[model samples]
Target chain A: MKQYDVVVIGAGPAGLAAACEAYQNGAGKILVVERDKEPGGILNQCIHNGFGLHYFKEELTGPEYAGRFIEMLNNTNAELMLDTMVLAVTEDRKISMINPRDGYFTVQAGAVVLAMGCRERTRGAIGIPGTRPAGVFTAGAAQRYVNIEGYMVGKKVVILGSGDIGLIMARRMTLEGAKVAACVELMPYSNGLNRNIVQCLNDYGIPLYLSHTITEIRGKRRVEGVVVSRVDGGGKPVPGTERFFDCDTVLLSVGLIPENELSRSAGIALDPRTKGPVVYENMETSIPGIFASGNVVHVHDLVDFVTAESQRAGAAAADFCRRKEQPGGEPAVAIESGENVGCTVPQHIRPDRIDQYAEVFFRVGRVFSNSEIEVASGGRVLSVFKREHMAPGEMERIVIPKKFLENASGGAVTVSAKEAKEN
Target chain B: MTHLICIICPKGCHLNVDEQNGYAVTGNGCPRGAEYGKKELTNPTRVLTSTVKIKGGLHRRCPVKTDRAIPKGLMFDAMKLLNGVELSAPVRRGDVVLADLLGTGANLVVTKSM
Candidate 1:
C-alpha cells in the first residue's frame, strides 16, 4: 500500500489547482488521480474563450486555462496518476483505485479532496417523451463530439434548454455549417450568462423561445423533428400552443448535478440543495480530514471561481496534513438562506477558523433590480450589500466581517435579497 | 438609439447607443461598454473559435481561435478557411495557422498544443 499526505481526485481544473496549492503549502507526498487519459478534463473539450478573466486577469480559452494550471502542476513535485479511476473512498482516508499499469491498489492519505466535478443531465434524467433516437444528445456530448472528436453531430437542430452549453453549441453548430432552428427554454428567463445569450444566440439570428419546452420528439430511428409548446407559470404545457420544428438533432442542456458517489460511499453528509457535501468555511466536509471543492461541491458558472475555491480546499487539506489532528474551534454558526436566496455554500462557519471575514456564495431565486443583500443574525441586521441587478443565473457573493460575526447573538446567520428602498 | 449588451466581460452591461449623438452610449458600467456599443452598431465583430483537423496527435481535432475580433460578416468565410487546413502533431499554442484572416487583420492561432 502506498501512502500520501494528501490525495486529490479528478485532475480537472479543480484537482489541478488544488494539487498545486497543496504542494506549495508544505504538503509532501501529494497524489492527484485522474480517470481520463488527458489531464485537462472537461476543459479539453471546452475550447471556447471567455475564461480566466478573473483569475489570470487575461482572457483565455478553456484549454488554455487548464494548460496554465497543468504547467504549474508539472513544476511541482506532486505525483499525477493518469488513466486511473478511484473506486471507493473509505472514511478513514483510504482510496481504492485501479489502472491498467497499477492494476488494483490502495493508498492511505492523511487528507482527501473531492473534486470529481459534475455531469450533464441526460434525456433519461429529464424523461423527455421521445422515441429512442440516435440524433438526440446532451449539449455537452455534442460539444465533445464536435470540438474534440472532430465530428459534426447534426445539420438541422432544435435545442432544448438555453443554458450556457446549449447557447455555445448553437453557435458552434452554426459555425460548422449546420442550421440551428431554435433554442427553447422552460424557464421564462435564460439559465446562462447574459453575454452568452448576446454572443451565441442573438449574434446568429437564432430565435429563443422562453417559457417553452419540447412536448414530443417525432422520430423513429433518428431525430426527424420536435413539437415545442408554451408552458404556464406552473410549468404545465399550455394546450393548442404547440409548434413543430423540422430538425435532425435535439440537444438537451437542462442542468448539471455534482458527481458524488464516492463521497456518499464514505458516508459524507450531503446537502440536498447542492447535491454535494455539507462543508465548513474551510471547505472541510462533515468528515474531519476530508475536504471537497469545485463543481463536486456545487456547479459553478465560471471556472475562475472553481480555481479560487479549490485553492482554499487545497490549503486547508495541507494544513490538516501538517497538524495531523483536528484542532478544537469555536462553535460553528450555521448559515440559512432567506427570502429570494436559493442556496449558500460553506453551510456554516467557525469564528476561530476564519481570518478577517467569511465569504458566502449564493444565487437568487428570481431576478430583481436595485436589490440589497442583507445579512442578519438574532433578528438584527449585521450588514447590507447593494447590487444594481441580481439574477438567478448569476452567482453572488458577500463577505461577513469578523466584527459582525463576533457581534452575532444568534446561533445562525440568515442571508436574503430584498428590493432597495428609494431615498 | 441602439441597445446592446457589452460582451467585454461577464458583467453584461446593457448600453443604449445614441447614434444621432455621435454614437454616445449610456447605461454602461465601463469605457469598454461605451466603445462596444458604438462599434456594435457600426461595424460588428466577434472573436471566432473553432476546431480543425489534426494528424499524428493525441486527438483528431485541434482547437483554434482568431487572435483578435474579425468582422462579423466574414465569420463564415473565416470558418471556410479552416476546412482545407490539416496540421501534424507537435503544434504549439499561439502558432499561427492563417495570418490576416479575410483581410480582417486577425490571425488564426492554435489555442491548445497537440
Candidate 2:
C-alpha cells in the first residue's frame, strides 16, 4: 500500500487550499483527491462574481477564485487525483478511492484532511407537495445547467428560497430573458447576503414573499404553476393568504447539509448542529491524525472563511505528520454558545496545543441591535464584543486569544449576546 | 432623501442620503459607507459578471465579467451587449471581448477560457 504524509479529500476551494498549505507547511508527500472532472468544484458552475473580497482583497468570479488557488497548487508539491471518488476512510487514516481510470486503490496517510464541501437541500428533503414533474430542479442543478452546460432549464420560474445561489440565479435567469414570477422565502429574513438581495431581487423588481412557502406545485408533466401562501411564525400555512404563480419551473434554494457520509463512515464524532465532525482547535477530529475543514465541517457563509479554515487544517495536518506521537496533556475545553447564539465551531479547544488564537465562527438565532456579545469561561467573563446589528443570515466570528485560553479554569467556555445598556 | 444599504461589507449599514443637501449621508458605519452612499445616489455602478456563448470548448459558455464596475443603470444594456457575443475556443482569461463597455471604460473580459 502506498503511503503519503498528507491526503486531502475533494479538490474544491477547501481541498485545494488545504493541500497547498500542507505542502507549504513541509508535508513531503501530499495527495489531493477530487471527485469532479476538474479541480474547480462548484466554483466552475458558479460563474458569478462577488467572491474573494476578503481573501484576495479583490472581487472575483467563482472560477477566477478557484483558478488562483489552482495556480497556487501548481507551485506546490501536492499531486492531484481528479475524477476520483473517495469511497471510504478508515479510522487509521487509510482512504479507499476509485475512479474510471483507476479501478480501486487504498492508501495509508500520516494525516487525512476532509475538505469535501456541502450539498444543497433537495425538493424531497423539504417535502414540497409536488408531482413528479420534469421542470423541478434544485437551484444548484439549474445553475449548473445554465452556466456550465449552457442549457436553459425554464423560461419562467418561481424560486422557493432566498438562498444566495437562488438569488443569483434570479438575476441570471432575468438576464437570460426568463421572467421570475416570485421568490417565496419561508423565513422572514433572507438567507442570502445583503448585496445579493439588492442586486438580484430589489433591482430586478422581483416580488419577494417573506414568511411564505409553496404549499402545492400544480403540474402534471412539467411545472405549470405553484400554489404559494403566507406562513405564521409557527410555519403553518395561512389559507386566505393563498396565492398562485403561473410558471414553468420551481428552483429550491432551501438549505445545505454537510456532505459527511465518508466522515461518518470514518467513525469520527459528528456535531448535531453543524452536521460535521467535532474537532479540536487544530481541526483534528475525534480520530487522531484525521482533520476536517470547510463546508464539510460546517456550512460557511463565505468561501473566504472556508479557505482560511482549510489552511489551518492543512498546516495542522502537516504538523501532525512531522511530530512524533507523545502523551497528550490537558483535556480540551468545550466551547458552547450561550444566549441568542446558534452553534460554535471547534466545539473543543486544547489550550496546550500550539496556536496564536482560535477564530470561532457562529450565527445568532434571532436578530439583535446594539448588542454586546460576551465570552465567559467557568462563570468568569473572558471577552466582550459589541455589534451594531446581528442577523441569523450573517455568520458572526470572534477570536479567543491564546492568553485567555491558556489561563482558563479548565472549564467549558460559553459565548452569549445581550442587549447593550444605554449610558 | 434616497435610502440605500451599504453592500461593501457584511455590516450592511443603512444609509439615508439627502439629495437636497448635496447627498449628505447619515447612518453609515464607516467612510466606505459614505462614499458608497454618495455614488449610489449620484452614479451607481456594479461589476457585470456572466457567460458568453462559447463553441468548440469543454463548456458551451465561458464566464466573463466587466474589467471594472460600470454604471448600475447600464447593467441590463451591458447584458444585452454580451448576448450578441459568441466566441470559439482558445479564449484566455482576461481576454477582452468588448472594449469601452457602454463607453464606461469597463471592458468586458473573459474570466475563464472554456
Candidate 3:
C-alpha cells in the first residue's frame, strides 16, 4: 500500500489548483489522479471564452484558463496519474484506483481532496415526454462532439432550457452554419448569465421563449420536430398554448448535478440543496482529513471561483497533514438560508479556525432590484450589504467579519435578502 | 434612446444609449460599459472562438480565438477562413494561424496546444 501526504481526485481546474496549492503549502508526496487521458477535464471541451475574469484578471477561453493551472501544477513536485479511474474511497482516507499501467492499487493519504466536479442533467434525468430518438443530446455532449471530436451534431436545432451551455450552443451552432430556431425555458427567467443571454442569443437573432417547455419530441429514428408549450406559474404545461418547431435536433441543458458517488459511498454527509458533501469554512467534510471543493461541493458558474475555492481546500489539507490532528474543538457557528435565499456554502464556520472574515456564497430565490442582503444572529442584524440587482442565476457572496461573531449570542447566523426600503 | 445590456462583464449592467445625443450612455457600472454602449451602437465587435481541424494531435480539433475583437458582421467570413485551415500536430498556444484576420487587425491564434 503506497502512502501520500495528499491525494486529489480528478485533474480538472479544481484538482489541479488544489494539488498545486497543497504543494506550495509544504505538503509532500502529493498525487493527482484523473480518469481522462488528458488533464483540464471539461474545460478542454469548453472552447469558448469568458473565463478567468476574476482569477487571471484576463478574459480567456476555457482551455486557456485550465492551461495556466496545468502549467502551475507541472512546475510543482506533485505527481499526476492520467487515464486512471478511482474505484472507491474509504472513510479512513484509503483510495482504491485502477489504471492501465498500475492495474489495481490502493493508497493511504494523510488528507484527500474530492474534486470530481459535476455532470450535466440529461433527458432521462429531466423525464421529458418524447419519443426515443437519435437526434437528441445533452448540450454538453453536443459541445464535445463539435468542439473536441470534430463532428457536427445537427444542422437545424431547438434547444430546451436556457442554461448557459444551451445559450452558448445556440451561438456555436449558428456559427457552424446551423440554424438555431428557438431556445425554450420553463422558468420565467433564464438560469444563464445575462451576458450569455445577450451575446449568444440576441447576437445571433435566435428567439428565446421564456415560461415555455418542450412537451413532446416528435421524431421516430431521427428528430423531425418538437412541440413546445407555454407553462403556467406552477410550472405545468398549459393547454391550447402548444407550438411546433420543425427541427432535426434538440439539445437539453437543464442543470448540473455534483458528482458525489464516492462521497456517498464514504458515508460523508451530503447537503440536500447542493447534492454534494457538507463542509466547513475550510472545505473540510464531516470526516476529518477528507476535504471537498469545487463543483463536488456545489455547481459554480465561473471556473475562477472554483480555482479560488480549491486553493483554500488545498491549503487546509496541507495544514491538516502537518497538524496530524482534528480541526479546532470549538462549536461551529451554523449558517442558515433565510427568506428569498436558496442555499449557502460552508454550512458552518468554526470561529477559532477562521481568520478575519468568512466568505458566505449563496444565490437568491428570484430576481430582485434594489435589494439588501442582511446577516443576522440572535434576532439582531450584524451586517447589511446592498445590491443594485440580484438574480437566481448569479451566485452572491458576503463576508462576515470576526468582530460581528466575537460576542454573538446565538450559535447560528441567518442570511436573507429583502427589497431595500425607499428613502 | 436604445436599451442594451453591457456584455463586457458578468455584472451585465443595463445601459440606455441616447443615439440622438452622440450616443450618451447611462446606467453603466464602469467606463468599459459606457465604451461598449458607444461601440455597440457604432460598430459592434466580438472576439470569435472556434475549433479548427488538427492532424496527428491528441484531439481531432484544436481550439482557437481571435487575438482581438473583430467587426461583428465579419464573424461568418472569419469562420469561413477557419474552414480551409488544417494544422499539423505540435501546435503551441498563442501561435497565430492567420494574421490580420479579414483585415480587422486581429490575428487568429491557437488557444490550446495540440
Candidate 4:
C-alpha cells in the first residue's frame, strides 16, 4: 500500500489543476491518477478554439487549456500516474488504481479530489430509433477520429444535436473537405453558444433546423440517408414534415453526464438536476474529505471555468487536509430554477460568511430576449440582473453577492426570469 | 438618452445615445437589456481569440489565446498581427506565441502543442 497526502483522480484539466492547488497549499504529497496514456483527458483531442476566454482572456483550444495547468503541475510536487485507472475509491480516501505497467496499488490519502470529468451522451441514451450502423458515432468519438487519429469521419453528415461538440464537428467536417448537409436540432433553440452557431454554421452556410428531429436512420452496413421531421410545440414529430437527406454518417451530441460512479459507490449524494455530486460551497461533497470539480461536478462548457472550479476544489481539499474546517454557521439555501432558468450549480450556499458570493452557473430552459433575472429568498429580491437574450444552449453564470447570501435566513434561494418589457 | 444594449443576452440592441442625461435607455427588450446596453455602448469591448501560424509541423494551426480580455475595437488589429505570425514546431502548449500582442499589454499564448 502506498500513501500520499492527497490523491487526485483523472488527470484532466480539473485533476491537474486540483493536484497543483493541493501541492501549492501545503499538501505533503500529491498523486494524479489518469486512465489514459496521456493526462490531458478530453482536451487532448479537443483541437478547436473557444477555451480560456475567461481565465486566460484569449481563445485557446482544449489541449492548450489543459496544457497550461499541466505545465503548472510539472512545477509542483505533484506525481502523475498515466495509463492507470482508479478501480474504486473507499469512504476513507483509499483509492485502488491499476495499469498494465504498475498492476494494482491501493493508496490512502488524507484528502481526495474527484476530477473525472464527463462522458458524452451516446445514441443509446437518446434511444434514437435507428439501426446500429457503422457510421453512427458520438460527436466526441468523431472528434477523436478526426482530430487525433487524422481520419475523416464522413463525407456527408447530419448532426443530431447542436451541442458545442456537434457544432464544432460540423465546422471541422466541412474544413476536412466533407459536406455537412445540415445540423438538426431537436429543441426550438440551439443547444450551443451563439458564437459557435455564427462561426460553425452561419459563416459556413450550414442550415440549422430548429424544432426538428431525426425520426429514423436509414442504413444497413453503413449510413445511406436519414429521415428527419419537424416537431410540434410539444416536441412530437409532425407526421407531414418528414424530410430525408442522403448522408454517410450521423453524429450524436445530445448532452454530457458527469462521470460519478465512484462518487455514487462511496455513498456521496448526487444532485438530481446535475446528475453529479451534490457539493457544498467549497466543492466538498456530502462525504467530508472527498471533493469534486469540473465536469464531474457539473458539465462546464469552457475549459477556463473548469480550471477555476478545480482550483477551488484543490484549495479546499488542501485546507481540509490541514484540519482547517470551513467555519460553519448559517444554513445554506437551496437554489431553485424559476421560469426560463434551467438549474444552478453549487446547489447549496453558506449564508453567514462575509465572502458569501456563490458562482451560480445555469442554462436557460428556452430562448428569450430582453430578460430580467432576479435572485430572491423568502419573497425578498436579493439581486437582479438583466440580459439581452438567454438561450438553452449556452451556459449562463452569475455571482450571488455575499450580502445576499448572508442576509437570507431560510435555507433556499430562488432564481426567476421574466421577459423584459419593451420600451 | 443612454443607448442601453443587452449583449449579455443575444439581443444586441442599438440604443439611442444620450450620456448627458441620467442613464435613460431606449430600444431595449428588458431592464437588464437597458443596463447592459448602456454599459456596452458607453464602454464597448469583447474577448478576442485567433490562431498563429506554426512552422515545420504537420499541424498547420496551433491555436493562440489572450491571457485576458482586451478592447473589442482592437480585435481587427490583433487578427492582423496574429495572421502574420509563424512559429516553429516542438512548441509546447502554453508557450508564448507572441509575447505581447502589439503593445496591447496582453500576451498571445499557444493553447496546444503541434
Look at candidate 1 and tell me the lDDT of residue A352: 82
The reply for model 1, stretches above 4 Å from the true place, is none
As for TM-score, the candidate ahead, 2 or 4, is 2
Per model, state how many residue pairs clash.
0, 0, 0, 16
Task: Write model 1 residue lDDT over A1-423, tens digit each, in one string.
Answer: 899999999999999999999998999999999999889889999988899989998889998999899999999999999999999999999999999997999999999999999999998898878688789999999999999988999999999999999999999999999999999999999999899999999999999999999999998989999999999999999999999999999999999999999999999999999899999998999999999999999999999999999999999999999994678666888889999997799898888899899999999999899999999998998889999999888999899987777777867899999999898
For every candidate, the chain B TM-score is 0.97, 0.84, 0.97, 0.62
Model 2 ranges off by over 4 Å? A326-329
> Model 1 - which docking category?
high
For model 2, residues A1-423, the per-residue Cα lDDT tens digits are: 999999999999999999999998999999999998789889898888878989998878999999899999989878999889999999988999999987999999999999999999998898988677889889999999998888989999999999898999999898888999999999988888887888889888999999999999998899899999999999999889987899999999999999999999889999999899998888989998999999999988888999999999999999999999743766788889899888888888887785688788888988788998999988899999999988888889999987788777756789998898798
Which lDDT tens digits does candidate 4 get at residues A143-232? 877765557788999999998889988877875668999999988887777657765786568999999999999888999999999999
TM-score, model 2 to reference = 0.97
**Residues B1-114, candidate 3, lDDT per residue (tens digit)?**
999999988778999999999999999988999999999999999999999999999989999999999999999999999999999999999999999998899999999987
Where model 3 places Cα greater than 4 Å from the true spot, the runs are none
State the lDDT at A229 in candidate 1: 98
Q: What lDDT tens digits, residue by residue, belong to model 1 across residues B1-108? A: 888888988889989999999999999998888889999999998999999899999889999999999989998988888999999999998999999888888999
lDDT of each: 0.93, 0.89, 0.94, 0.79
- By DockQ, who's the top model here? 3
Better-scoring candidate (lDDT), 3 or 4: 3
Two-way DockQ contest, 1 vs 2, winner: 1
